[model samples]
Target chain A: NAGVTQTPKFRILKIGQSMTLQCTQDMNHNYMYWYRQDPGMGLKLIYYSVGAGITDKGEVPNGYNVSRSTTEDFPLRLELAAPSQTSVYFCASSTGVGETQYFGPGTRLLVL
Target chain B: AQSVTQPDIHITVSEGASLELRCNYSYGATPYLFWYVQSPGQGLQLLLKYFSGDTLVQGIKGFEAEFKRSQSSFNLRKPSVHWSDAAEYFCAVGAWSPDKVIFGPGTSLSVIP
Candidate 1:
């Protein structure tokens, strides 16, 4: 069912460049989340959505934005890419809060 | 705020040997704990979770974890290690929401034949 899917598995961006990371889930989950994982560190939440048209900031939401236009899609936007933003970004979804979240393959971003 | 700690950064065990990975968490109220495994170049997969009741929870790939409330620890164990079990294991604590979950730094497991 393609539990969760992300686009451009690997990407490179220059300083100040902007991009959008696309994520889609077929699980019909009501919750979606964005997280960034740095080397030697655990994942940090960037943003999340409770349902379509409802989004909220997470632990590390700075320099990032998200939108949940449909139940199946949640996209993360980077307004101005910076070196610190270079990390692997993962998208996940769950049926509800506290449910087992299914993750996508992840998008590796490198800012030069 | 909830947090998790994985004491071991890396561990090595011979094939068919017993194995254990330690995890500790801090939270104000009853904790919802989980263990996930990640293989190289792959996404994280749920191994097991603990909500309430049973202190011992079974997971996939012949793995199990014991939750000790007194010590605030949830340790993963395997009776017999396999080469395929070599991966990074993460312990996390959270409430009912996924965004509230906090992950540990992760422990790397290596199996030698």
Candidate 2:
């Protein structure tokens, strides 16, 4: 079973470019999350969803939006990417509260 | 509000030597703590966590973490360092229920042969 799968393993976007990073999990987990990792910054939560159609803002949700159309899919949208938004994005899911989150391979994004 | 602090920005250890990474958290209530390791170009992998039960928790890859309630710290330790263990380690904390997890500035581990 594929735990979590992310698309567009790597991408480069110019200023004002918009794109979506797709994340899907086959674990049928109830909790899904989006995070970005930067040098020495560890991982900061971008957005999260408890279940389908129920998304919530997280610690660093200023420049992105997310949608949870299905239990297996959670996609992040960057309307106008900026240089600061360039970071490795990760998707994760957990079976339930206080559970270990399984992470996807990650998508490397660079905004020019 | 909840926060995590990884005091060590970077650490260097000789192979076969013991290693420890410090992590401190500040939360109003009981905190759920976690340690995740990230290799080059890879996503974060769970090493260990602390929620309840025993204070000491053993995790994969010969790593372990001890939860100290009084100190509000959950420190990760390895008996011996391995070359493959060189990576960035993150400490995180959150509420007992699912929500946003606060992450500290990660500690990068370098193992010398």
Candidate 3:
């Protein structure tokens, strides 16, 4: 299985530009999550979905939005990119809350 | 709220030497703990996790962690270090219920010959 997959391994966006980061999992997990990791720092949760059509905000969800249309897909949307949003974004999935999370390769974003 | 802390920013150890990475967490109840390793420019990979059962948990790559509830610490240890083990390690904590998993800053390990 692909475990988890993300698109556009790397991207560079200008301020105010918008983009969508796609994430897909083939493990049929019920829980999915979006997180960002800054240089020399740990990951911070941006958003998560318990299942299809159900999503919720995470610790740092201010500049991001997410939609889970199918159990295999969860996409994060950035309405207006900023310098602070320049970081590596990771998508993860798990069978349940507090369970082991399988992570994707991550998308490196640079906002200029 | 749950939080995790890794006291050491970076550590260096000679090949075949013992290694240890410290982690501390704060939460109201018993937390689900995890240790992950990330190579440069790569994604995080789970090394091990602690839910209940025994306090000592074994992980991949000859790594193990001991959970100490009294000190709120879950420290990762390896009997012998390898050059390939050089990477950034992160400790994370989560609640039993639906909650965000909190990750520590991370500890960068460097293995020397």
Candidate 4:
């Protein structure tokens, strides 16, 4: 099974351009999260979903938005890309709270 | 707010030498601790985790960690280092409900032959 899959492994966007980073998991996990990793920094949570139709902002969710319409999908949207938004983004899922998370390869974004 | 810290930004070791990566955390009550490794160009993978019971926890790839509550530390250790073990290691702290995790800046390991 494809544990967690993210689309567009690499992307380049212009300032003010919008795009969505897609994430899917076949494991049927109830908890999903989006995180970004900058150079020399630990992963920072952008958003998280408890279940379908339930979402919440995380530590760093300023320039992003997320929606969970189905259990297998949680997509993060960047409304207006900026240089600061350029980073490696990861998607993770787990069966429940306190469970070990499975991470996707990661999407590297560059805003020009 | 809960947080994790990896003191070493990078560590280099001769192959077959002992290795340790330090991790310190700040949290109230009991903490669930975890270690994850990321190979270059690869996603992160779980190494081990500590919730309760024994303070010493064994993990994959001949790695282990000791959770010291009094010191608020969970440091990863290996008896002998392998070249294949070179990767970035991260320490994380979390709980059961709410399931929010805080990750520390990773420690990159390099093994020289």
Candidate 5:
């Protein structure tokens, strides 16, 4: 299985710009999550979905949005990028919450 | 509230030496603990996990962890360290069914030859 995959491995965005980070998982996991990791800091949850058509806010949800249109896809949208949004974004999915979350290669975004 | 802590920000060990990375967590009940390794510029990879039963769980890459409920700790240990083992290690804890995990700040492991 391919596990989890994320697109746009690296990107640069100006303040107020917008973009979407694509995430897809070959495993039919019901739960998907988005997290951002800052330098010398732990990963912070941005958003998550238990299944298709279900989404919820997480620890750091500001300046971000997420949609779970299908069991395999959960994309994170940066709708007004800010300097704070510049960090490594990771997409993970699991069979259920608090299970072993398989992570994709992170996306590094720089907001200037 | 659930949280994880890797008290040591960085650890250095000579090749072939034993290594231990500390991890402590805060939660109300029995927690699902995990250890993950992240290579530079990559995503987090699961090293091992603890749900119940065996407190000491063996993971990939000769990594093992001991979960101590009294101390609220789940420390990762490797008997012999290799240069390739240099990476950031993260500790996380939470349980299933209306629970979410929180990760530690991460401990960067450096192996000297």
Candidate 6:
């Protein structure tokens, strides 16, 4: 099964531009998460969903939003892109709490 | 609050030499630990995880980690290093709560011939 997949491997956005990063998992995981990684740094959680129709903010959720309409999809939305938002975004899914997470090949965003 | 830290930012070892990457975590209770590897321009891959049972946990790619509760540390080790082992390693700590996982700054490994 395809563990997790993300769209638009790379993107460049101008200031104030908005976009949605797509993530999908076929493993029927109950938990989905969005994280961002800066150069030479670890990942910081942006948002997560425990299940369909339930989403919550994570550590660095100031500039992002998320929705979990179905168990297979969790999308992150950026209302206004900024330079600080330029980072590698990863989407992950897990069976439950404290379970192993399967990660997608991240999307690299560049805000100019 | 849960947090993780990798003391060494980068480490270099010759091929066939022993290797170890240190990780420390802070949590109020017993924490679930994980180690992940990331090759350049690639996604993260789980090397191993420590949930319960034996303190010494074995992982993929000939890697193993020992969880020391008293020290609040989980260190990854490999008996013999190979060039293919060169990658960035991240240590993470989490609990039963959703979105509570915390990742440490990765430690980059360089294998020399």
TM-score of 2: 0.96
lDDT of 6 by residue, B12-64 (tens): 99999999999999998988999999998888999999999999999999999
RMSD of each: 0.9, 1.2, 1.1, 1.0, 1.1, 1.0
Give one digit per residue, the lDDT tens place, for model 6 in A1-112: 9799998899999999999999999999999999999866799999999999999989899989898999999999999999999999999999999988899999999999
Score each candidate by Cα lDDT. 0.93, 0.91, 0.93, 0.93, 0.92, 0.94
lDDT by residue (tens digit), candidate 3, A1-112: 8789999899999999999999999999999999999866789889988999999988889989999999999999999999999999999999998888899999999999
| Residue pairs whose backbone atoms clash in candidate 1 | A98-B96
Model 2 bad stretches (over 4 Å): none
Better of 2 and 5 by DockQ: 2
lDDT of 3 at A60: 89
| Sliding window of 10 residues with minimal summed lDDT for model 5 chain A | A93-102
The Cα error of candidate 5 at residue B80, in Å, is 0.2
lDDT score at residue B82, model 4, on the 0-100 scale: 94
Superior candidate under DockQ, 1 versus 6? 6
TM values, all candidates: 0.98, 0.96, 0.97, 0.97, 0.97, 0.97
lDDT at residue B106 of model 1 (Cα atoms): 95
Model 2 per-residue lDDT at B70:
92
Looking at model 1 chain B, report the run of 10 residues with the lowest lDDT sum: B92-101
Candidate number of the best DockQ: 6
**Alpha-carbon error at A84 in model 5, in Å?**
0.8
Write the residue-wise lDDT of candidate 4 on A2-80 in tens digits. 8999998999999999999999999989999999999778999899999999999888999999999999999999999
- Per-candidate clashes, comma-separated: 1, 0, 0, 0, 0, 0
Which model, 1 or 6, shows the larger TM-score? 1
